[model samples]
Structure formats: structure tokens, C-alpha cells
Target chain A: MTKFTTRLPLIGIGVFAVLLLVVAPAVLSEHWISNLGKYCCLAIAAVGIGLAWGRGGMLVMGQGVFFGLGAYAMAMHLTLETAGPGALPGFMILYDPLAPLPAFWEPFRSEVFTLVAIVLLPVIVSAILGYALFKRRVKGAYFAILTQALAVALAVLISSTIRETGGDTGLSNFKYFFGYVLNDEANKLMVYLIAAALLVVCLLAVWQFNRSRFGELLVATRDAEERVRFLGYDPANIKLFAFVVAAVMASIGGAMFVPIVGIITPQEIGASASILMIAGVALGGRASLFGPALGAMAIGWGQSSLGSSWPEGWIYILGLIFIFVILFLPMGLSSLFDRAKGLIRRSSDEPGPATPELREVVK
Target chain B: MSVPDASLVVSDLHVQFGAFVAVHDVSFDAHPGEVRFLIGPNGAGKTTCIDAITGLSKGTGTARFGDKELLGSPAQKIVRLGVGRTFQTASVFAQLSVLQNLDIAAGLRRSPVSLLRARRGVDASVERALEETGLGTVRDLPAGMLSHGQKQWLEIGMLLVQDAKVLLLDEPVAGMSQDERTATGELLGRVAANRVVVVVEHDMDFMRSFATRVTVLHQGRVLSEGSVAEIQADPRVQEVYLGTAGALSGALAPGAEEVD
Candidate 1:
């Protein structure tokens, strides 16, 4: 069972890289490329979900808090970049013409600071949150609900702070990204490439983690936390690490979401959005390495295509699929492949009467 | 008696849940190189005693392993202090292979950075644990798929790989057949050669065969402490065992002198 996570799907990864880097760019128009970029960011976040929820048994329902942090961080810097040096953003000027730039927004003017904030912001917040939650051993549904509430709270806070954060309208209309013109087709592709490349990097990192000793410990902790404690490990620390990593990954996805989608709204990093991310992960086989990413991308594609045709009805479709997966294929759609293989290889999946451990005990 | 630095000395331990005291001033000492047994009828507080010693439950009084106090420290800290325990139901990592379970247990001294890389080859300690537990043939099989007795051995093997100086196993042979029970006894004999092996059990036959020393507990306090032969001959143990468990088959040792 664990062999799926341990074995690196080399051919699959190579094909994915080609499609993301080469084939898609050559064949598709810019509109679809931009859509794929959004999906890429979502997929990046899903990989982390797989690690946290799938492997570590942490149902991190408030991942959008971290996503919001990264997206807003990147958006603030870009908004400031569009405002020119020493000038307040246009929204602040519109809301209060004489108001000074918020102190928190001032530091984002520096490119280095913006870059650091993308990763560090989520790390610090998640470190605190994870330390508190995991130390108390808050788990399962309670942990999930607590995290989801945080995302809602953050969204509400952002919604109310119209001047400082642009509130519900969010931060957009970015003319430049790190001195590069966002309007340029080549620059747009470059941003897309960056997001795509980062998704690949995240997948590789998680792959390494899945096969590593930490991965085994994470699984052990998930399956039987007390057993892990008896094995001389502080389960809190193990859980904290996975949760923080997942948060950071979500943050990175949000940061990338800004440059790709050209917007960072509270709606994108709220409770509903966070649930959507989880929906994708659960749709994919959460336990497998590529499941969450593939699942998220599939969901993204569905939203763009089927959603365009029937916006209200698409949600029903998603709900039905979710219910079906949860009921029959709890492992997600990826397990469908396993099921097919099981039908072909009937008897191989189960240990037969020949296992020496069974034979010796029987004798 | 003076307790050695390597011994697990649990003295006057008191554990309470609300107003009811589960373990009321129970005391016993287990040393390396012997298999210690804690035997009692149902609700005897034997499980509570080990739970407190392993820091799974809060308790008063001193349960010491070397210089470190076991009662106040956390579960992982007690484990780090070289004490390991197993649950009554065999709490091995069900989804992981036996080898993976042992690998995770043997990683006490591993650095966080090194854990990021995949394991290249099995550690000598893990290999030794596989050999010791007799799970070598099924090392790659998931622990959940193992036979009931094998899961118990795997749990013990996990502790062995951690190099735990003291092992507290709760009902290690509770669900085993006669053949499996003898095999487990032999395994415990080999494991106790250079460590403190403390077992909380109810099977009188396995206890008589494997226990180097026995402590009987009734209702939360220690009733008797002595060698297996001495405990068997004690009239007090006879009254507790025969009085409460005479109707229950195999709760008393075979061919013991009946109260006459």
C-alpha cells in the first residue's frame, strides 16, 4: 500500500513536465494557458494537502489562511509596484485621499521582502497554529472545523478592512510584476512557467518526503499516534512539521495565484475556496503521490469547462462526484486504477496460504 | 533493597480518576536480566500501573528509571528514557510493513535532516530486530495483515529496536493459541536476558512458565511479590485466584495445591 508513495512515477512525471512546459504552450491560446496557470497553483496547494491530510492524517480545513497570506503578500507588493515609489495604492487614495500608506504595506515595496514574506509568512503563522493545535492533540473533525473557522475569520477581516486591504474587492490591476510588464505575452508566459515550474518542484519535494524516513513516521503517527509516542517520538512535533509544510505550500500556491490570475480576493482564500481545494484532494487518491495534484487540476478543468456552460448545475455535479467517491471509492479516483488492476490480477493483492509467518504460526 | 540505576522502580504509585482511585499505592521494582510479571483478576489496576509508569496517565508517587522520574515526564520522554510499552490489543502501525515499524522505532538517535532522505539499506539494529522477533519472512508485509500473535511479537520487536532497557507489555499473549503462547514465552525469555521485561498478564500457564518473579495485584494495591514458586505457594494468592477466578478456566496454574 505504501509502495505507491515510495515509488517515483518517473514516466508520469516526465509526461506531465512535457505537457506543462512544452505541449500546452505550443498548442493552446493564451486564455487557456492562463487558466492552466490557475490550475497549476491549485495543484501545487493540493500536493501539500496530500502530504498533510493524506499522509499525516491532518484535516487542515483552514489552508486558505496560509494561501491568503501568500497571495495578499504578493498582491500587495505588485499593487505597491503599480503605485510607483513612495506612493500609496490607488484604493487607499480613493477611500481616503490624504491617508498615508499602511506600515505593513510599506515593507512589501522591497522585492526581497515580498519574496521572503511569501514563504515566511505562512511558516510563522502555521508554526504558531500547529504548535497550539497539535500540542493539545486536537484532531479529526475538531481540528478540521477549527481550521475552517480561521479561514472564514480571515476572510471576514479582509472584507471589513477596505482601505488597508481593498476588502472584498481585493488587490488586482497589477501593471508590473517584479519590474516585468504583465501585459506582455512573453512575460505572461514566463509567469505561467514559474507557477508551473514551482508546482513541479513542490511535487518533487513531496515525493522525496513520501519516501523518506519522516514520511514513514508521519504515516505511523497518523495510523496510531500513541504507538508513535511509544516509539520515542513526540507526535506533536511530527504533526507540527507536516502541518507547517502544508501551510507553506498553500501559501506558495496563493502567491503564485496572484501573478497568474491577476487578482487576490477574499473569496479565493475563504472557507469555500479552502473546501474546494480539499474537494480536489479527496477526488484524487489523497494517499498517492500525484493524486491530489491531478485531482485538483481535474476539478479546475471541470469548473472552467462544465461550469461555464451550467454555473449553478456544475456544483450539483461536483457534489454527486464527491458523494460517489466518498461512498464507494473512498481512496479517490486514483484507486480506480488499482481496482482495475485488482480485477486483472485477482489473487495477487492478497497474501496467500504460503506466507511463512502464517505457516509457522499454524504449525 | 537498593534499586540499580538500570532498574525500573515504581514505588507507592497512586493513580486516580475523579474520586475513584484506580491504582492506590501500588509498588514494585523490575530489574534488567529478569522477566517480571504483574498478575491479577479483572479491574486489578495492573494496566493503570503501567500506564502511569509510561506517563500515559498522571499519577503521584515515584516511578523512577535511573535518575529520571517517569510519573511527571511525557510519554515520549519516558520512551526516550529507554522505557517502551505495548498495548493489550497490539498497537503496531497497521498500514506499514513490519520492517518499517521497526525502522521508525529504531530512529531515536536520527537527526531531523537525515530523515528527509530515503532509507538506503536496513540498519543493523532493524535487521537484528527482524531476526529476533522471527518476522524476517514477512518483514515486507503490512503489520495489519500479520497473525494476532505475530502482531504482538512485532510490537515487542519495535521496542527491542529502540533498545528500550525496560519493556512493559500488557497482556502480550491474551489471544494466542497454546503453541503461540509457548513461542511468545520463549521470545520473552530471550528478550529478558539483558533487559527489564515487565509483563501485565492473566494467563497463569504462561506466567508460571516465563515469569522470573511475580507480583499479584488485587483492586489497586500489590498483594504479593516473590519468585514464581514462592507466589504459587502463597496462600493469599490462592484465596484471590481461587476465590474470584476458580470458575474461570485456566486462570490458576495447573496442578497447584488446592486449598485443603
Candidate 2:
């Protein structure tokens, strides 16, 4: 059983890699390609959420803070590049009129600075928050509430900072990314590829972390903090590391999201957005390798398709899905697929603990 | 074998909750490597004394870990200083695997941050701790699924990982089957080989089997301290046990006649 579990991950990864890298590009249409790219970025964020919430048992509701940091950083760079020397980005000029761009925004014009900020901002914020909260021994509902509050506050702050942050409208309408025109089909595909590649990398990183000693400790910390403490570990530190890693992943997703979606709005970095990320993670299977990424992407696709025809009803659909997933599928969608496979394997072998429904199907 | 000093000295220890005094001017020492049984009828500060020693509760008492002052130190610090403990209720991380529980407990002695990213060597220690507490088979199973007795053993396994010089166990066998009680008694006897083990217990059978010395507390005061027979034979203990002198003598009269 252990051998099968070990081999199954490798097989799954290989199959997924082939499908994503080879088949996806060959079969998907330009529009679908762009959409897939957007989902990929979301998947990255979901991966992080999975680590923090699923593995570490921290309900981090304020991932948007890091997401916003990455998005705004990338958005700032794209805006500055389009504006040229000495001229402010369109939103800054419209909102503030006479004000020069914030000094902090100056560095983002450089691609390297923008890239670094996308990763570093989330890591730094998460580290600080994780350190403080974990050190104080805050866990369970309190940690969840605190993270949610942070997300809420960040969203409000971004929305209110009309001059600097582009307010509720947010920074959008990018012409070029690096040198490629973002409007071009090829460029869009490239962005999608980048998002896909990053998502894969993030998954691999998390998988490796999970296999590592730290991963075991994080689970331990979640389950038996005092025991871990007695063993001589500060559970706070273990939890903090996982939390910060999750935050950084969310930030990277948000950064990539701006380019692929061609928009960065205050709405995407708000409480609702954070909840949406969590919903996807929960729906997918919080602890599973592909659950968060696939779950987030699936939700992203759902919102894009269903949201257009029924704007008000889309949120209700998501809510309903979340409720159903939690109620019927505690292990998330992954377990359902595993159960199906189990039934198939058992049919070829002998009878096992098959449910009445499964037995009927088998017969 | 000559025993080391088992003295647990607490000088001017004070604990307050806003304006409530939980422990006041409490001073006592259990000799090293001794099964010091702290027996109190109820609310006699038995658990409080253990908590103060393990630094779980805030107390203004100088709890000495050998020669070092344990006052103002965090619970983890106290554990590191060779003072291991268990809670009144079984406190195990229910969601984690049993092996993972021991791993975390063993890993607790190291910097979890560095250990989190690395995944070797810690397993051996965890396995050893598990072996010590006889939780080897269910190591892969989730701790939440463990029986209550198993959970208690797992908690003890966590303590073993700390390798503390002193173990402060609060009601170690509060809820257990007859077999579990016997197994636990045997386990504690094995554990007492190297450390100062202080147990707060209500089960006289469990305590009498292993306790080298017993300290009885009544209404936040030391009632008596001696061997099991010596303390059990005391008139005050008899009064406390029977609830009245007349009742105690009446109960003993039948036993006295049988012995005669």
C-alpha cells in the first residue's frame, strides 16, 4: 500500500505534466488558452492556501494581502513601462493630478524589482504575521479571524488609497509585457505558459516540503502543538513557516494574475477574493497535491463562464458548491476519484468493503 | 544504588489571576528519581503544584530544576531544562498520525524550523520514543483514532522525547481499563529508572504499587509525608479517609478483629 501510494504520486505528476505542457497547448483555443492561463495563476495561490490551511491547519483568510502586493507590484511595472519617462501612470494622474508617483513605485518600473517584490512582499508580510501570531500561541478560530480581518483591512485600504493604489477601479489596460504586446495571441499564450509553469513549480516545491522532515513537523504542530513543544519545538515557528510560504505563493499567483487576466481590481484583493481562494482549496481537497490548484482553476473557469450570463447568481453557485463539498465530500473531490478507482481495482480482484451503491454498479 | 538529591525546592512562589491567589507561599521538594506521590482529596493544589513546576500556570514560586530557577520560564523552556509534564486531560494532537505525534514530541527538542525542511534522523528518535511507550504498531494510524489508554501512552511518549530530568505527570492514568492500568503502572516503573517523576494521582492502587514516598496535602497544606504504609497508618489520614474519627474507628474495628 505504501509502495503504491509513493508510485501513484509520481505517475500522477508525470501524467499531469504531459497533459499540461504538451496536450494543453496543442488542443486549447486562444480564448480557452487565455482562460486556462488565468486559472493557472489562481492554482498557484490555491497551492499556497493548501499548505497553510490543509497541512498546517491555519485558516489564512488574508492571503489577498500578499496577492495584492504581487499584483500591484506587477501592475505598477506594466503601467510605468507603458507611460515612459517622467509621466505618471494613467490612474495616478487621473486620481492625484499633481502628485508624483510614490517613491516606492519607482523601483517597480524595473522588471527585476517588480519580480522580486512579487515574491518578497508576501514572504515578508507572512513572516511577520506568522511570527507574531504563532509566537503568541494563537490557533484555531482566532487565527482565522485575525487573517480575515487583515484581508478586509487591506482591501479597504487599497480601495481608499485612490491616488496611490488606483482605488476600486485598480490598475488595468496594459499594452506590453516585457517587450511582447499583451494583446497579441502569442503573448497571451506565453503568459498562460508562464502561469502554468509557475503552478507546476509551486506544486513540486510543496510536494518536496511535504516529504521533508519540516512537513511532518508542520502536521505534528497542527495536531499536537504541546507535544511538539515538549519535544522541544516551538509550534509557533513551524506553523509560521508554512503560513509564510502559503502567503508567498498567493502573492506570486496575484502577480501573474494581473498579466493573464489583463486586470487588477480592488475586488480581486478583498475579503471575497480571499474567501474564494479558500473555497477552491476546500473544494479540491486541502491536503492533496493538485486539489488546491485544480480546485481554484475549476472555480475560475466556473466564474468566467457562469458569471457572464448570471452575474448575481454566480456567487450563489460558488457558495452552494462549497457547502456541498464540505457536507458530502469531507476529503474533497480527489477522494471521489480515488473511490471510483478503488471500485474498478476491486472488481478485478475479490469483494472488499463495497457500499451498496458501489456493489450495484459492480454487478 | 545511591540516589541523587530528589529535593524539589520552591521558595516564595506566588501565582495570581488578576486578584485571585491560586498558589500562595507553597514550598515543597520531591527527592530526585523518587516516585513522589502528591495526593490530595480534592482542590488541594495538587495539580497547581505540578503546573507551577512545569511552568504551565503563572506562579510566583522559585521552582528549581536541580539548581536553576524555573520561575518566569515558558513551558517549553521548562521542558528543555529537563522538566517534562502531562496535562490533567489527555492533550494529544488528535488529527496527526500516532508516529507523527511522537516525531513532533521528539522533534520539539530541536529547532523545528530547520527540522521542518530536513527529513532524516528524527524518525529514529521518534521510533525509539514510540517503542518506549509501546505505541509502535499504531504509529502510522491517526492519533484521534487511538483508544483513551493509547492516547495517554502517546502523551507519555511525547514526554519521553523531551528526555527531561524530571517528569511532572498529572493524573497519568485517570481513565483506563484494568489491563491499561497495569500496563501504565509497569511503564511508569520503567520510566522512573532515570528521572525524578512526580505523579498526582487519586488511584491508591496505582500509586501504592510504585510510589517510593507519598506526600498528602489537605486544604493547601502538607498533611503528611512518609512511606505508603507509614502515611496510610497515620490517624489524620484515617480521619480524612473515613470522613470522621468515629466512622474511621468503626471501619477499622472489623479489620482489627479479623487480624486479632
Candidate 3:
């Protein structure tokens, strides 16, 4: 029985992988497949939120900053790649036809540098920001507000710099991905497969982290930080580590999001975007292994389908679903699975010897 | 073998909270295998003095644990240097199991990278801690579900697993039953057999039953320090702890009555 219970996670992951990578591609239409791919990117970001906000209890309300950083890096590289060496990007021609491509754009011309930046920029930023914030013992709503402020600041900064970043209109009109023809249907499907595969990889990473001793310490720090300190573990450094991991995951999601969606914008990496990422995780069961990914996809699907049908009404519908989940299903959709497992176990087992309950009695 | 002079020595220690002074020029020496009780009225600076020594609060002067100085370091650094402490309230990781709580505590003495390693069977130290704290029976239960007495035992067990040479407990038996208090007193006696255990408590009966040495604080300074017998006989100690002679018999005894 113990062995069966321990193997449950492995079995679940196997099923998830089969359904995500094998089953979905075989059945879904090309348009829906592309949509699912976008959801997978969001799911990748949600996995990080589950680690930081759910497990570590950091309440990261500004994940958009990391997501924006990753998205812009990839978008810049794609724009430069399409512009084809020494030729200015089409948008830059409209703004200032003779202006130099800018010093920052020179580095993105190298694919190696862009790829490295996608991973490192968010890691370095989160590490420095996390170290300063956590060391000073900033947490709860104060931490949340600080992060949200950073997301807003980045969005506004990007919107005002039209000459360099394409302003409120945002970066679009990509013609190639790593020198492959972007308009090809097969290539689009390939991008979808890559996004789905990366989502699975993120899940596996989180699974390893959840079972590690650091995972236990993160939960302990969440519950009683003072006790962990007295036990000789620095809570700040532990929190910083989780925060950095979350940032990297979000950055990866954003990096993939550019090719899959075919555009990158400030609106997609704003305060609302960060909150939407969290809403999906919360709807799925932020603490569970599969909750964040499934919840994110469900929310993304809702926006695509429900939003097109009713337009502005989709936000209201999404708000209602979020509220319902928060109110009735505080543990999110995953609690239903846990409840089912518990019921099955209880029905299968025989009655055991009764033991006295240990209840506290105040004198 | 234990280090030479493994005793914890504090001299001329002063604890100030902003503009207010909580402990003034306090000094004491605690050796290994000794269980010392710190007793006094509300705001007597007993907790403050312990906090300073454990690096929870900063202090002026020296708190020497063998050759290492403890006063200026951070709380986690102080704990890593061999001083461990428990809160006034029993603060265990509520979500984790009893066994996991001890496992994480034991990680303190091990390498930081040990977190990546898989958990093996109950090692000797954790096994000993679980047995010593009498928590082996319910090691698999969630710590939050444990009774108040059990939580206190679990926190103390956490200290033991860390291989702490000096253990500071705040109000160790504040809300325990009479039977639980006696059991805890016995547990402390066994736990302090090879390490320094300093308890900040208010239960006079438990203190009388377990304390080898007593330090009495009043107005942020040590009013008296001696054996239990000397403290019981001191008129000033009685006046401070028990108030007037008329009020002595109200809730607390005034050395005249047999305790135990």
C-alpha cells in the first residue's frame, strides 16, 4: 500500500505527459493546437507561481516583470533576425529611417546571446531583487505591492519608448524563427510541440523540487520563519532561491510565448497579465503538482473561446469563475481528485483499531 | 569529548529596546549538565537577557560560548555556533509531520547540500531525539494535530536534533497539565545531562522541583542569584515574587509552606 501511494506521482506524470504531448496533438485542429500551445506557455509561468506564492508563500504579484524581460529579449532577437543584417527593422524605418539600430539591438543579432539572455536576465534580476527584498524581511502585502509596482513601471517604460520598443503599438510582424519560415503551417505545429514539451519539463523540475528537502524548508519557513531561524537555516536565502526559480520559469514561458503567439506586447506583460497568471494557478490548486498547469490552460481556453463570442463579457465570466473557485473550492480543482482518492481508500480498507484523539484542553 | 569550558558565560550584559533599557549589567555563568531557571515578575527582563545572549536581540558586553562570542551575531548564526532556542509559544511547523520536523532540524548540523539527498530511515540522532522526547509513538502524525504538551516536547526535540550545546526555552511549561509538567521536568533533567539548559518560566512548583540554580530578576537587573533554598529564604526575593506577606498565600506560597 505504501509503495503504491509513493508511486502515485510518477503514474500521474506519465498520464499527464501522454495526454499533453501525444493525445492532444493527434486529435486537436491546428488553430486549437496553437491555442493550447499558448496555454502551455502560461502554464509554465503558473508552475513558477505555485513554487513561490503557493509553497514559499512569497505572494509574487509582479511576475510580469520577468515575463516581459523574457518576451522582449526573444521579440528583439526575432525582429533583428527578420531585418537581415545592416538593414533596419520595418518599424524603425517608420520612426527614424536613418537612426542606428541602437547599441542594445547589436547584441541580440547573435542567437547565442538572445538565448542566453532569455534564461539569465530574469534569473539575475530576480536574484538581485529577491536578495534585497527578502533580506530586509519585506513580505505579505508590502512585497506584493512592490512587485506589482515593478510590473507597471516596466510596462509604462516600454510603452513610452516607441522609437526603440515600438511603444503602445508593440512589437509584431515577425517573418522567421531561428531562420525557419514562420508562415509555414508545419513550423507553427512544431512550435506548439516545443511549447507542450517545455511545459512537461517544467512540471518535472517542480516535481523534483517538491520532494527535495529545500521544499520542506520552504514550507516550514512559510509556517514559522522564526522557528526555522532558530533551527539555523537562513529564511531569507531560502526565499530568494525559490523566487529566482520562479522568475526563470516565467522567463522561459515568456521566451516561448513570442514564437507561439507571433507577437509580444507591453499589454501582455502588465499588472493584469501577472494577476491572470496567478488566477489560473489559484483556480487549478496552487499547491498541487498538476493544478497550476491545468488551471492556466483552462483559463486561457476560456479567454479565447468566451472572449471572442461575447468580447467584454468574457472578463465578467472569468471573474465569476475565479470567484466561484475561491469561495466554494478554496483548494481549487485538485481537491476533488484528493477527495476521490480518500473515498476510494476508505471504502477499500477494513475498520482498524480505534486510537484516542490528542486534543488540547486549556486550564 | 566536550570542549574545555563548554559553559556559557555572560558578563555585564545590557539589553536596550530603543530608548528603554530592558536588562541592565546582568552577569551569569552556566556550565554543561546544569539546568538553570530564570524567574521574575512580568517585564523582569528575563526573556530580554536570554534574547540578547541568543542573538535574538542585540546587547552590549560579551556572551562567550567557550571561545566563540555570541552577542553580535545574527540569530541563525548564533544557533549554528551551538546556541539553540525555543519560543515562548510552542512553534512547530504545523503542516509537516513530527518526523519531518526533526529531519529539517537535523539538517542544520549537516551540509547545506544535504537538502537534495533522499530521506533515509530514522538516523541515530533523530531516533534518539524522538525517543528522548517520548514522541516516537506519533512520529508520523502532523505536528499541528498534537496536543499543546506534545508540541512543546516536539520543539525541544528539534533543539536536541540540532546537536545544540546550549538550549534556551521560554516558558517551557506554561500551559501544560500537572502530569505533563512533571514529565517535562524529567525530560529537561535528561536533556541537560550533557548540555546547558536555561529555562525562563513562572511556575514556581516546577522550578522548585527541577532547578539546580535560580536567578531572580527585578526592574531589569538581577535582584538575587543562589540555590533554590537561598532564594526561598531571601526576604527580598519573596517581596518581589510574592509581593506583600498578606498577598503571599493568595496564589503563591512564601517559603513557609511545603511545595511538592
DockQ of each: 0.59, 0.38, 0.53
- The DockQ ranking, best first, is 1, 3, 2
Q: Best by lDDT, which number?
A: 1
> What TM-score, over all chains together, does every model reach?
0.94, 0.89, 0.95
State each model's TM-score restricted to chain B.
0.92, 0.85, 0.92
How many angstroms is residue A59 displaced in model 2 relative to the true structure, after the best TM-score fit?
1.6
In terms of lDDT, the poorest run of 10 residues in model 3 chain B is: B251-260
Candidate structures ordered by lDDT, highest first: 1, 3, 2
Docking quality (DockQ) of candidate 3:
0.53
Candidate 3 lDDT, tens digit per residue, B153-180?
A: 9999999999999999988888789899
Please, what are the lDDT tens digits per residue for candidate 2 over residues A178-230? 87899988888888888888888898888878877788877777766766676
**Model 1 TM-score, 2 decimals:** 0.94
Q: How far is candidate 2 from the true structure (C-alpha RMSD, Å)?
A: 5.7
**Higher DockQ: candidate 1 or 3?**
1
lDDT of residue A45 for candidate 3: 94
